[model samples]
Target: MITGASSGIGRVAAMQLAERGWDVAVVGRNPGRTRDVAAAVSGTAFVADYNSLAEVRALATALLERYPRIDVLANNAGGLVGRRGRSVDGHEQTLQHNHLAPFLLTNLLLPRLVASDARVVNTASLANRGGTIRLDNLDGTGRAYLGGFPAYCNAKLATVLFTRELAKRSPVTAYSFHPGFVSTSFGHNSAFVRWGLSLLASRQISAEQGAQPLVQLASVDSLGAASGTYFDGLYPNGATARRAQDDNLAAQLWDTTARLVGLTDG
Candidate 1:
């Protein structure tokens, strides 16, 4: 299952996976492009705007109904929205959409994932290198607007931290990777972001190239036991920071996230 599969790295990865005869599920916010991707890949398509928790829950239920076993849950639907905004769920836009929404969706589907002994590939980024996250107050508005790419970095950092946290308790394998600065519509909402990305076009790779690690992480038989690892593209990279390695912080973040998403039974 690939969220953000409507375009860029997600779409290319889905196509490649389909060509390899793997069952693919294309998910995205755009109805037209998602449908196109599903048709092109001959896979099922699910549409859920990440801006709404209700939609995320519904999407999870739909996926559970259609797919008895989800071998992979790629948390790939996220981007840096330039200006500060709130999601339909009332959380900050980038934090909620990029981090919290996926957090909720994955938990909602955790049972299916565990039943299948799934591999979860979180599309993380180097944006996390210098991020400052308020793990105690994950839904706090302050962290949501962590300034510029800091917001994105914090969310990406959370992605990595979540992987580490999940692996500690779940048998499911988890991996997070930086899909090398692939040229995508990630920050198309902001001209400033586009301009900044263009400056790095010399170092940027294609979306297909960026998707390689996700494909490998998903399909590699050798990595079936590989959990709580971060990759610099396809190769193993060091942790984002010492803070990301903080088990206490990770646990707190998980608890906070659970509470935010209404998972109170824990």
Candidate 2:
């Protein structure tokens, strides 16, 4: 199952996996495009807007009902912004969509994931270098945002932390990987970030290239033995920042996230 499979890296990755005879399920926020992608890959389509936590729950229930066993759950649906916003659940939009939404969905599908011994892949970012992880401010409710870059970084950092936490708490393998600066609609919502991303066009990678690590992490037999490791490309040699190295912080974030999402026994 791949979230954000309607376009970009998710689309490419789903198509590639489908070609390998995997029964891919494409999850997207856009119905038409999602159906288009699913049709292209001969896979199923699921639509859910991560901006609403209720929709995330609905998505979880639907996935569970349809797929009795999910072999791979890729939490690839995310975005960046130049401004701070809130979701239907009233949390910081970036935090909610990029981190919280996937977090909740994973927990909801835990029983199925464990039963199948699934691999959970997260599309993280190198921008997580200076990202902050504050136990007192998980949603950035009390902080001020100069721009969305910091918020995006924080969310990505949270993704890596959550990967580690999940690996420790569950039997399934979980990994967070940075796809480099892939040229996509990731920051199209912000004129400033869009222009900034355009300036780096010379350095950005294609969506197919960006999806390579995800494909490797999802299907490669070697990676099956590894869990909670962060990958930048073909290898797990890349490193995260100081804050991301905190086990205590990961534990706190996991507990806080469980409480926020109303999970009974997180």
Candidate 3:
């Protein structure tokens, strides 16, 4: 099951996996595009806006009803917000969309994933190197959010922390990855970021090239590495951010996020 499958790495990864004979569940915010991708891949399509926790819950319920066993869940639906906006759920938009929403959906489907022994692949970023995890100020209630790019970086740092924490607490394997700097419509909300992406075309990789790590992690039969390992492309990364490597911080973030999403039993 792949979120954000209507475009970019998720879309290409869905197609690639379908070509490999895997049944892909193509999920996205756009109904028409998501359905089109699903049709192309001969797979299922689900629509959900991560800005709404209710929508995230509905997506989880629908997914559980549709698939008996979800082999791989790619938490790939997220992007940068132009400002410190708020979701319908009353949290920071970037944090909610990128981290909280996926956190909720994954936990909601935890039972089925554990039963199926599924692997979870979170799409983090190299920008995580610039991020800091503040359990006390995760929502960026004040001037802490900085802006779109900084918030995006912090949210991605949360992604890695969540993956490691999940691996420790759950039976299923979990991994996070940096997909390089992919050329996509990822920073549509931030003009500065978009300009940066365009100006640095030499640093950007194709969506297909970026999807390789996700496809590789999702398609492997036996991932011999540790469950919570972070990947830099196809290989394990030794230089994860210091904050992301903090086990205590990861646990605290997991517990705090669980509460924020209204999950009582984390």
User: Which candidate achieves the best lDDT against the true structure?
Assistant: 3
Residue 188 lDDT in candidate 2 = 81
Please provide TM-scores, in order, for all candidate models, with all chains considered together.
0.94, 0.95, 0.96
Give the winner by TM-score: 1 or 2: 2
Pairs that collide, model 2: none
Sort by TM-score, best first. Answer: 3, 2, 1
For candidate 3, write residues 1-266 as lDDT tens digits: 99999999999999999999999999999999999999999999999999999999999999999999999999999989987788999999999999999999999999999999999999998888888888888876665444488888899999999999999999999999998889888888777787778888888899999999999999997767799998988888646778888999999999899989999754
Task: Please estimate how well model 2 matches the true structure, expressed as its whole-model Cα lDDT.
Answer: 0.89
Model 3 clash pairs are none
* Runs with alpha carbons beyond 4 Å of true place in candidate 1: 136-147
* Ordered list by lDDT, greatest first: 3, 2, 1
TM-score of 1: 0.94
Using lDDT as the yardstick, the better of models 2 and 3 is: 3
lDDT of each: 0.86, 0.89, 0.91
